[model samples]
Target: MPGIGPSIAAHLDEIFKTGKSRHFEAVMKGLPKAMFDLMEIPGIGAKRAYRLTKELKIGSVAELEKAVKEGRIAKLEGFGEESQAEILKSIEDTKAKSKEKRHLLPYAEDIAHEIIEWMKREKLVARVDPLGSLRRKASTVGDIDLSAATKNPAKVIEHFTKYPNKKRVLEKGTRTASITLPSGVQVDLMVETPDAYGALLQHFTGSKHHNIALRNYALKKGLSLSDYGIKKKGTEDYLKFKDEESFYRFIGMDYIPPELREDTGEIEAAIDHKLPKLVELEDIKADLQIHSSFDIETSHDLGESSMEEIIQKASNLGYEYIAFTEHNPSRSKHNDQQIIDILKRKREVVDKINYELQNRSAHLRETSARHSEKIDQINYSLINMNKKNIQKARPQATGALATVGRVFNSLEIDIMPDGRLPVPEDGMKTLDFALISIHGSFRLSKDKMTERVLKAFDHPKVKIFAHPTGRKLGHREGVELDWPKIFDFCKKNNKWLEINADPMRLDLPDVLVREAVKLGVKLTLGTDSHHKDSMENMNYGVSVARRGWAGKDNIVNTRSLVEFLELLKG
Candidate 1:
């Protein structure tokens, strides 16, 4: 307690004075509190808010709006037309009441998939499909829209209304119903006959702009489009399809995936049949970042599952490799030597598993070869005994046996406020891989923050920048930096950026991902998972990559363990 310091003592003293932090109040005096509130908008961070207040004389949302409308904000440095538009949109979104009701993509998808599976099990529907932004894999969804093809609409509607999780029924009808789930998520269901399901699916699973563009395209083709079907311009006859593929084929275009149906040249790409092969969940061969109990007691530590459990889970997922990038112990109570010992133990476990796996594989191969040689001897003897018996004596070789996955010892090292790594270079050299990250000190200026990150990239042992932007959905904006410069540095250094797939922190958001891809910056998809079930969130990262038009080659973990190691060496 002797070294408790003035700040802590002041905080304790102020607890009795006003039951709050006097330190925080003093800090708040440096800038208008309203500017802090303005920073809550999606596109505005602390730096931008400070700039708006000091440079533009805007201290509140209203003043920001006024500045935007008067065309004054666009004249400021770094405030272009696009920035102004985004700020205005963010301001509007901040003020909008319904914006708070939107759910994160993974949460919405889970609920939607559960309802679809439940309805399928109940036998009340032949097919059920979630539509709208949820199906499009948007980062957040407003409402869950579903379309069902069923012979009995009334029964399906009744069952939906009576579903166990339903908090309330907004409306009920024979063919349609809306219900609010327990989590305050609203779901709307439309039941149609099998003949019209495709049309409904295509119509409802849309970004409005995409649909309008499709309609215009149809008109040019002398066809009329609707939720019912495609109809000839001067006739009542309509073309119906059983699936989206045929529906798109009818329009003389290739099928566009829901994720790419954003009216962002996807329609034109479909017509040209030139869409890039999007990366898939199966294309991912490993998870590059994960935490275990070894990572406990650190900031943002998700230390639930043990290292063995994580390895088992990765093996079960059929992953060829996984890196246990535990939090570096430099920031914790452990000394460097203790951390090194722990890592040594982890490596021993991994080595034992690998040794056993190799031995088993070798034994299987030897047994297979011995059997094959025996079969060959039998065939030879049969041929000598009688030519007709050779076919019976011959035996085919069994397929190669499966092997256990490889586990690597890695660490998620912190980039300190001054751009130095928390772990020493000696400690870092022992890691199979190092994922450098920013844990705090998010208020650095853009230039300073960019320099800090670029310095971290200069570390010879650092292989990846984990959750590079550090943004958390709906909570905080990431540190401001010149991302184009960062991307170029990464490309030149052969360093990787992580598409962290945690629902709250899908860092390297899609737009940045597209930019990174264009810069030839290699990407690694990490669930940043702390538990077994969270490993499945890898698909979220894959979704982000797909939205950015990244192919399998753009990702690093798609390679086998040997290939990945070789690439790391380069």
Candidate 2:
């Protein structure tokens, strides 16, 4: 709709009705479909696709790979050894991954920020936004989708094609352009006028089913929806909006958060004015899954960051509290008494840190009083008003939250195959509380796995279940468990579930998180950070919580230290 002039539009009605124009067959008569597949490989574009097929009889990816391996491709003019090697590596990479491979959200964010900043400076671009899965905060995303608000579509497309590190421009058109990054990740950009920006965002930020259901609902209301704007059913008139909130309000419902637009009863909730005030990163006051470099000799990876370094970083983040939930000392390496001694030593170190924290408390409060900024990172409705603001909300420090009053001395204990904790009871006594999790034996049956976890929760000090699902994205599926029973146990026994914030393990995923929310099971956020730099991952955890429809009240770590302490005592 954006680049369609009246003259070109007049010829597209029949094409739209039948999916293609009659000239399509004539235009594609001699083209090999395999060339399209080859073009998907990073090192191959349209010209290369044609050259490889024409000269080497390379049609499919397999045939191309064979030709490459046999040194047939390097012999071609305008191709060299370096080019051949690059193409071979790209083919090998394509072979290694599943067809549905998606980049993790953080990785995609890095690329989007760099590219979006580039696009924003273009004179023709009035605004830029991420669309679809990235906008919805999905844990993993496919192609990075972007939209530009502009008065000049053609100029924006030309500028976008010139992105500095792009491997090739896949397609260039009047309304849209696609380019592949060096990593083979595709980025798609669309141009639209500022007045219809909201319509464009809502139309494409879809989780297919959400849009389908929305269209059905609109049809019943004698209205039609499109990227251009809302249309009256029997007339050609359209109503345009510049923001998503206004767009939803015009439809007689509360604005649905992008994270909740997954056809998961969000439409019904919006109509009833029951959409959640979802949790925000600023509401969080603690990071509960930190590991310290203080070595008690762990069974797994030891932390690379020291407790003092982590505290400094946490203070910089405006946190009021944090925990040192390092892995329990290896049971095989240390007997029960040895484990007790190690844990007691850790407790002593934590006590010293807490003592220093108390000494700094008065100064911390004074500093906070001096700086009025609340560090409003991840503010609600992170849409049009400010794109750059959402990424880096504030650099000013709020000292009141600095040097959290005390560092909770905690341990992430591994649950043995038989449901026994690796940490002895005497050792656990030195901790504020413990987080138990399944590190192995993930192949156990659903009923048995649930039983094992419940048994682990039986320990009075085992207050939270860490990374409850035990999933490693892109590698391992989470262990199976009976959720109804698990939720009941946590709700009734005051046990908490953790949403691990690590990019590789965003466990207790959004779907389970929503279920836990319904059953009133409290959840906590943990970055599982071994390095201080990883502490920033807490934002990703908050994203998962928001996606699950969790509000500030549902997340335990959102509480003030006093509130969290009271709950622990309860």
Candidate 3:
């Protein structure tokens, strides 16, 4: 706690004041206890320990070795002069203390979300955005700031005090409040009215260095700018800005997004404002491939989805399409009939829905024309039609209902096995979508792995690669991706990459994903879900995509149903 006075106290305040205390576990998990102990050494101070921990990731004796092997400890300022001898001596000195650490990002994310949600509800702040190093997507973050635009200041203070079920309010002020939460996440809630919110949000979201640069820039213009507002350096002629965009305009800068708010050259970039549009979640059109309960042997499920359920879930998700890329019969516990039956049953259900929906259209149109207010009501009832009634009515209304809106515009199969892709006798014009996957090649050499994947991409009928790395969470490192070569081939061949959404296998981490994007690779995220429950995993993939800075155009699924089909056809 020695080095933890104001800054550490503030960080602790964040944990205790907000529900996000759990996020710190990962950060602490990555730190060594011995590093804390080292701070207490006779000559060592918290600054030195902070420096050592920052550079070496040293917590105990073992990490000392790791830091040395990683060439981090030797690179520190004073240590660099006699790095060879001093680093070794430092390791020997701390060798007695040791512990293990892990990936701390999850914990940080959890805490960040807590503060975010808290700010939204308590502060009445709309459109709160993350800023600073965390926004930059760094592997680690020291502390976090939440910037929110609110109409009222007193409400902001009240909300922060109430939420995370705060244990105690250590300090309270109009703009800022310090409090402790039950979980030990110390937090500070800073509030600004909507008038000053945008500019302040931009400033607060930046690193100290970035803030300094902006300040210096303002000074050069004979203007003084702070998180509150901007005004002439000598006069109180501070032009009160109404929003973030106006703030940028006042300073002759383009609006800076949260991600690039780091202390780097973002200020200059904002001035030039030539930032490329970042990819967003709405851009995806189709989830080309996913699993079902049928492919349970190699996958997690033993049975496939009831055809009706799968289509309904896809519809609910606003997906124009979804593919059932079940395991091939040759390699799995399924028989040909089982696979056939699943498809057969799915088609039957879809046909039945389409038939009923068609029949209801004429009546729906007549009702809506006479009673325009009843349109949505009529459509809702039509959509709520059950399978039993639809099936029963199919024969009676088959002819009339043929004009109804189709319940399913897109539905397809995903076939996966070891042999060459299934192509039509006519060649290259067979299936709606063909997704290839890697299931058993986790241990192959890099070249062999690369060769197999390259072959799959070259196959004309193969539309997308599923779970490209075959990595499972908390279990295995994926097939080591030879990205430089693989991405090169994908770019040239026009192959799409899958950011598998299975929680255990978010294979294409944002780092590799960004690299793929830089090389002009179109990325796709598939739930690869064995159950309907898993379809929600796409959100996680989106998170990874957001971290990678993907844009809608970069993702294939954000297209419309028609466009998606065309993509498959191409």
Candidate 4:
């Protein structure tokens, strides 16, 4: 067997010597790195971890201590009742210190920005600045510190007290006030002269770690840092630094980026300016799949697929096109022939609307002939304007009206006893957009289930694999086929994955969606609505897509209908 790491080997050695070992490594591998570290201690495994985490609500080692002290472990599953008191007794036997402090400064930058903007607007602040841990860009901020060049901070402090959405006033004095926002953000206002503002900001922004490192480095160079100034210890005179950058330069360190001010080797990296650029939400475009009450059971109102309604709902969502993927014909009991006939009728309706609008010039002339001279002159003027304007306006109004017409159009279907009928296949492939989904036999093993879905993907007509996991919230866990493998196969085959928009079934969770995107798997947003009303779920799918960090390029549904058809060809 390969030698394990020192930590695991030592753990195994201790467990084996203590005669309290079973499936330790197996449990460790399944947990997250942070969670794994917590589980490595004696008496911690899948059962205990689950018990402590789920029932006792024990997250970190500190929480575990509380659970043990409270004797809550015995209440968890797989733990015997007698083990509860023993666990608490054991926790009492251990010695560990709990450090309680505000985790990070809260809303430091927002406070800084608000205060600076206010100072600039009010003219009381000659020169206002944000300093302290916020300027260092620490990951966690606890409070905001503002240094403004003002003769009187009374007005600024008073403004803060009267500020909208103020939650709590922590401290108040003539020149300073600390208050919490409704959002739990805390800010401290400090009034100072322009000459001392930089020193005050530098003092406030000190990361205790960075400060200590700087102090130790400075001490070696015969200097000390304080609110007054950086001064040589032996000499009372100041170091005479002009700005924050010069202060760091005098101390032999490069300027650090605010986001990296955690003293996590960021100071050293700042020497070389090696900060990695992080991607923001603005980089994303397009949300792939979503649904609208298109599923038969989900759209229980009519026991039928509402394509027109779906289209109108999609239009309302600002979507140019949407995949009207109903439940697969194989799973649905509805007559396929009837579905095809209905689609044919829908196509005719679309054609009629298109034809009426296409010949609107002639239609308008005819309709205008029946009106008075005033109406005739108005009609002639409208028609004679610009062809481009007429073309643009006609399509826009017709598209909206066409969508409304579809929403009101209803068709009924009764599935025969045989449960085998041909769904209408509209030969008019003008829409050229559809997604396929599975609706039966979810309780299968991974290999069998994956193979079943693979067949659906192999079908040329299936553009997207809808609700891949089929996990329904607060209900069934759904079949567990390996998602990485599924997403990989889909990427290789140019198939899109549906982020099913149902709140209960945001099937492709954000994490999985991110992984799928990394593998270049195209995503399709589907409301998966069975009825017109449920089509609102497209927004839900879009939200999930945004959560997944999906941009427009990664989404199949964001493309033109022509592009969608071309992608389906793949």
Measured against the true structure, the TM-scores of the candidates, in listed sequence, are: 0.75, 0.80, 0.58, 0.41
For each candidate, what is the lDDT? 0.82, 0.88, 0.61, 0.55
**Which digits, one per residue and each the tens of the lDDT, describe model 1 over residues 49-141?**
888888877755567888898888888898899999988888677546333577889888889988887788758598999999888888888
Q: After aligning candidate 2 to the native by TM-score, how far in Å is the CA of 485 from where it should be? A: 0.7
Q: Judged by lDDT against the true structure, how good is candidate 1?
A: 0.82
Provide the global lDDT of candidate 2 against the true structure. Answer: 0.88
Candidate 4 similarity to native, TM-score: 0.41
Q: Let me know the TM-score candidate 2 reaches against the reference structure.
A: 0.80
lDDT of 2 by residue, 1-570 (tens): 899998668558767788776666676777777687788889789889988888887756667877888988889999988899999999777645532569899998999999999998798899999998999999998888999999999999999999998866667789999887778787889889888889998999998999988888888898898888899877997899898888888887899989999999999999899999999999999999999899779988889999989999998888888999989899889899999999999999999999888878976666555443443423534545565545535444455445567689999999988899888778989999999988999999998899899999989999999998899988899999999999999999999999999999998899999999998999999999999999999999999999999999999999999999999997
lDDT of 1 at 51: 86
Clash counts for all predictions: 0, 0, 38, 44
Which structure is stronger by TM-score: 1 or 3?
1
Please give the distance, in angstroms, between residue 255's alpha carbon in candidate 1 and its true position after superposition: 0.6
